[model samples]
Structure formats: structure tokens, C-alpha cells
Target: MLAIVSVTSPIFLLIALGFAAVRAGWIPREGALAMGRYALSFALPALLFNTLSQRPLDQIIVPAFLFAYVGGSLIAYALGLTAAAVARRTHPLDNAFFGMGVSMSNSGYLGYALISQILGAEALIAVAMSILTEVLLILPLTLILAELHDRRGRHGLARTLGKVVFQVVRNPIMLAIAAGLLFAALGWRLPALLGRTVDMLAGSAAAVALFAIGGTLAGQRLQHGLGPALAIAAGKLLIHPAAVLLMLFLVPAFDPTLTQAALILSGLPMVTIFPLLAQRYGLGELCASALLITTLLSFFTLNLGLWILGS
Candidate 1:
């Protein structure tokens, strides 16, 4: 519909602009990386903190929505891992990375930008909740699986688990979420000046993050690994959303907006760090190709998803 386009077009345009800028050499590769780092470390954390801190404790946690979203993601992850294990039958680490490609959603950058614009600031609670689930549960699980596959029992299970826990706690996004939730629970409010400063940083997150995503895509090689990449893309763009829909149906009562938000977020491409994580396991080529393919394909798929929801 025109209304949907009106809401989504600018967000895509910003992404396109970033893509073009990078492709045309308007922004150097290093600059794009720096921009992405800034968004991830500062802008996004500030935005999450601002949004979560101001919200009531109850609003920050939605059991039904979290259950549906996390359940769907786990199902998709399991399916992808099974398919990869069966098809390759040699590299368990690769299978774990493949599963990651299928399961992780680019919620922080693409999903947040789109949902905030389309659904407004109040809808951010859903986005935050999804991000929390990703940071806390899905990401660590996949990383541990991949690490275990790589180590092959050489490393002690306790040590591996401890390392993953440390990494998660040290993550700025997770720390920000924890801080925000604590403030909300304690009924603390930011001073007027500090609140305005946080808002200023948060306001820049969407555009910069999208632009960085575009640039990141521009930097990836998209020709190789087409076969497996396409399969992973299908899992991300189609199967993930379908899983979310199924879980939503299973949940007896849920916030309709949160349900819709979960679907949209599920339909997004894998998180921007997919390739970086894959690089550690030497699966970068496949994951990068899949990320690019899914991200480019998501415009049409997301539009279709929105249409389906509207109808």
C-alpha cells in the first residue's frame, strides 16, 4: 500500500544511499567500519538505555511476545543446523555458522529503524525485547555450539561456558540493557540535561546504522557460495517469519503490536556481524554471501510480509 511505502521508503533510501556511497568510493571502507562501530557501541546502546529506562518495568518484559519470538528463532536455528549437518556431514562448526546465518535477525539496525518509523517510539519495547532475547540467549547458544565444534572436547566445557558468559557481560549492548532495566526497576529518572543528551545520540542511530549496513554489504563479495547462501537466505527471510507466525498462533493471548513487530524483525536478514563471526570459523565466504543476498532480497520480502499482515 501507499501508506506502507510512505513509511518504509525513506528507510530503504537511506540504506541505498549508504550502499551507493560505499560502492562509489564516497566513503572509504575504514570509514564505514568506524561508523558501524560508533553505532553499535554508542548510538544503539544509548537508544536502548533511553527507551528502556523511561519505560515501566512491566512494559520492558512481555512474556508471551518473548516466548513466541524466542521459540520461533530456536526452531529456525535447529532446522538450519540439521540441514547443514546432513548436507555437509563433515564440518560441524560450519553447520553452526550456517545455523546462525539462518536464525539471527538484524534487529538493532534494520528492524529498529523500520519499526520505529512505522510503529512509532512506543513500539520500541518490542524491538528492545527482541534484542534482549538475541543478546542473552540465541547468540551465546550459537557461539558455544560453534566453539564446541571447533574445540572438539580439547577445551573444558566449564571454561568455554565461562568465556562465553564473560564476553556477553562485557558487551556494551548487554551492559546498557542491564543498566536500563535496573534503572526502570528502581524507578530512577535521568536528569533533564542528561536525558536530552541521550535523546540526541539515540536520534542519530537509525540513519547511521542503516548507512553502515549498506556500506558493509557493498564491501562483501557476493558471487561465490550462491547455492548454500541462497538456502540460508530462504531460512532467514521466509522460514524465520513463518516460525514466528506459528508460535504466535500457539500463544493464546499476546500484544498484537508485539506480534507484528516480532514477525517483521524475524523477516530481517541476519545480523550485521554474521560474517565476522563466521570469519573465526573460516566460513566467512558463505556467511558473507548469504548476508548480502538476504539483505538485498529483504526489501521485497519485507514488503510482502507487511502486505500479508495488512490484509
Candidate 2:
């Protein structure tokens, strides 16, 4: 347990520093937001492209691992949707967001930071696979459902689907993943200067991303929607990882390291954008509150998960 904490504590410490910087007014809220944007838009994408392109395509593409992760996610999503529909607390329009909150792990930022620390470069294969699954499949499905169920949208279904496609098409992270795979397939390498630049950017990703997340968390408030937030957090921090673990048993086996990566990543809190998306459905505050609680609680859950997996 102490060994696990030794590995995980520094990551949380960075997160805590970000929160402190923002809360103490050392960094303005806008600055924190910009930090997040920088990490997401620049650092992370660069890191993904560099890590992925340098690896062999055979090692990068593991269909069984992808299936297990996605299968686990869908199970959690179904549970969230079922809870939203059956529970008295959640609003009906919140079904999509609720489903999303439980399923969408914070893979881009938090997951990468921790997994890379624990598993080193090998974690990238699982990270890339999970990120691709989240962005390409789960996210689109959630948006489609949100648009279909959300009565406030003036756009037609076709237009909404088209918009979703364009958004995915232009996503920097998605582009990075695609470009990385292409490079790997062709056995291409960047020039020395360019490679150095990518390495520099990649090096900054984990720390900056972790700090940005903490800063973002500092800004969230749980003023209302306490009931729903707790429920969502519980489902996200508890059920999601369990579902993923179960799928690991049912699906075709892969490398144990990749298996551990999948389990750990699945245990992460929901993505930071969860609340922003739920805002369209008038559940922004609820999701934000849920996110805050989930992230806070994940510290212990993550520790326990790592200890268990290691044990």
C-alpha cells in the first residue's frame, strides 16, 4: 500500500499545487483555464504522436484490449442510464449526461499522468487505445443520444450528426492519434530537431495536465445537486472500474501490463468536459458537482485499485 502511495502521491501533489495556486489567487482562473488548454491542445497531442509513432504498429493495435475497455465502459454507461431513469433524484433529460459521466474516464489528462508513471512508455498503447475508443466511439454515441433526446436543439438529427462528425474530424487529439498510426505504419521518423521539439513537449504533458486539472477542480462548487452528484460519483468511482475488471475476464486476454493499464484507467474520474456537455441539458451544475466529488473520492479508490492490482 505504501509502495502504491509512493508512486501515486506525487501526481496528486502536483494536482494539489494547482488547486492551491488557483485558490490562493497566485494564478488567475483564466490562467488556469489557459494552462488546461495548452496541455490538451499542445502538450498531450505532441506526447501521443511521439510515443505512438515511435512504436511498432503490431504492439499498438490490440483489438482484445480495446474491446474489453469499451465493453466495460458500455456496461457502466448502461448502469448510469438505468440509474437516471429509475432513480427519483435525476432529471429525465439528464440520462445522456449521466450515462456519460460514469463511462468517460479522464484518460486524456489524469489517466495518462498516472499510468505513464506506473507503467512507463508501455502504458501508451493502452492509453492510446482507450483515448481512441472514448473519442471515436463512446463520445459520438453520447452526443448522438444527447442531441436526439435534447429537445432544446433547433437543428435536425442529420445536421447534429454531421456536426458531431466534423467535431471528431477536427479534434487535435484524434488527428494526433491518426497521424501517429500512419507514421508507425510507414516506419517514418521525424527529423532530429523536430523529434527533439516533440520530446520537449511530451515531457511537459503529465505535470502540466495534472496541475491544470487540480486548478479546474478548485473552481468547482457543490452548492446544490448534492444528491445526484454523490450518486454519480459513487457510480463513476466504484462501478466503472469493476465493470472493466469483469470484462478483462470475459474478453480475450492480452499483456498483463496492458491489462493493469486498462483497469487503472477505467478507475479514473470522469473527464473534465463532462459538466460542460451536461450544461446543454441544464444539468451543468449537477455534473460539475458530481465531477468534483468523484475526483476527490478517486484518490482513495485509485490507491486501493493500484494496491489490489499489484497484490
Candidate 3:
């Protein structure tokens, strides 16, 4: 346990420092947002590209791991949607957003940092795979459902699908993943100077991203829709990981490290963009509250998950 704390403490300490910095007015919320933007738009993508590009193509693609991760996410999403329907009886759009909040883990920021520290460079494959599942499958499905619910059958399916595809392709993270895969497939190596530069940027991603998450949390209020918010957080931190564990048991075999990484990723809080995504449909406050709650709770949940996996 002490060993586990030794591994995990620095991650949360950076987060705590950011939270304190923001709460103390040392850095405004906007400053945090700017840092987050830089992390997302540049640092993370560089890190991902470097991680993926250096690996052999076969090592980077793990089919069983992808299936287990995606299957678990889908099951959790369905459970969340069902719960929302029975409990809240809210608009379908709201339910879709709620379901998304439950299933979408903060893999890029929190999961990547923690898993990379524990599992080393190989963990990046799991991070990349989880991001692919989120970006390509879970995110698009939820957004399309929400859009359809909002539009009320006024829009055509083909157009909606097209728009979603376009948006996913244009995402910076997605582009980086694609480029990295292509580079790996071609057996190309980065020139020494360029590689060093990317390495430097990649090294900054973990701490900056974690600190930015804390800063973001400092701006969120814990009030409003407490009942549903708590439920959503519980689903993300508990049910999601449980589902991943089940999937790992049932699915065809995968690398044990990847299985562990997937479990850790599943146990993370809702993605940092939860509030921003919710804002598109005026569900920001509910999502923000849930994000804050899940993030706080995930400290304990994630530690428990690690112990379970280690055991």
C-alpha cells in the first residue's frame, strides 16, 4: 500500500497544487484554460505521436484489448442511459449527455499520466487505443444521439453521420494518432533534433494536463442536481471499471499489461471536456458538477482499482 501511494502521490499532488493555486487566486480560471488548450492542442498530441510512431505497427494495434475496452464502454453507456431514463425521465438529449458522462473516461489526461508512470512507454499504446475508442466510437455515438434528440427527427441520418465523421477526423488528437500509425507502418524514424523536441513537449504533457484538470475543477461548483450528479459519478468511477473487469474476463486473451491499463483507464473520471460538450445543449452545470464529483471520488476508486489489479 505504501508502495502504491508512493507511485500515485505525485500525480495527485500536482493536481492539489493546481487546485490550491487557483483557489488562492494565484492563477485565474482563464489561465488554466489557456494551459489546457496548449496541452490538448500541442503537448499531448506530440506525446502520443512520439509514443506511437516509435513502436512497431503490430505492437501498437491490439485487437482483443480494443474489443474489451470498447465493449465495456458500450455496456456502461447503456447502463447509464437506462438509469437516466428510469430516474430522471429527462429529455433524451439530457440522458444521452448523462450516459456519456458515465462512460467517457479522462484517458488522455489522467489515465495516460498514471498508466505511463506505472507501465512505462508501452502504456501509451493502451492510452492511444482508449482514445481511439472514445473518439471513434463512444463520443460519436453519444453526440449523434444527443443531436438527434435535440433536432427531433428534423435532420437526416446521412447528414448527421457525415458531420460527426468530419468532426472526428478534424480533431487534433485523431490526426496525431493517424499520423503516428502511418509513420510506424512505414518504418520511419524521426530525425534526432525533431525527436528530441517532441520528447521535450511530450514530457510536459503529464504534469501540465494534471494541473490543468485541478484548475478546471476549482472553477466548478458542487451544487445543482446532486442526486443525479452523484449517480453519474458513481457510474464512471465504479460501474465502468467493473464492466471493464468483466469484459477482460469474458473476452479473448490480451496482454496482461494492456488489460490492467484498460481497467485503470476505465476507472478514471469523466473526460475533462464533459462540461464543454454539455454546454452545447445547456446541460453544462449538471455535467460540471458530475465531473467535479467523479474526479474527487476517483482518487480512492483508482487506488482501489490498482490494488485489485496488482493483487
What TM-score, over all chains together, does every model reach? Answer: 0.97, 0.97, 0.96
40 in model 2: Cα distance from truth in Å?
A: 0.9
How far out, in Å, is residue 162 in model 3? 2.5
Tens digits of lDDT, candidate 2, 129-204: 8999899987998888887777675557898899899999999899999999999999999999999998999889
lDDT of each: 0.88, 0.88, 0.89
Model 3 lowest lDDT segment of ten: 147-156
**Model 3, range 203-269, lDDT digits (tens) per residue?**
8999999999999989999767799899999999888888888988988887888888999999999
Q: How does residue 9 of candidate 2 score in lDDT?
A: 94
Error of 2 at 217 (Å): 0.9
- Cα lDDT tens digits, model 1, 107-203, are 9999899888777888898888889878888889888887787844545678879999999999988988999999999999889999898899899
Cα displacement (Å) at residue 84, model 1 = 0.7
Clashing pairs in 1: none
Q: Of models 1 and 2, which has the larger lDDT?
A: 2
Model 1: how far is 85 from its true place, Å? Answer: 1.0
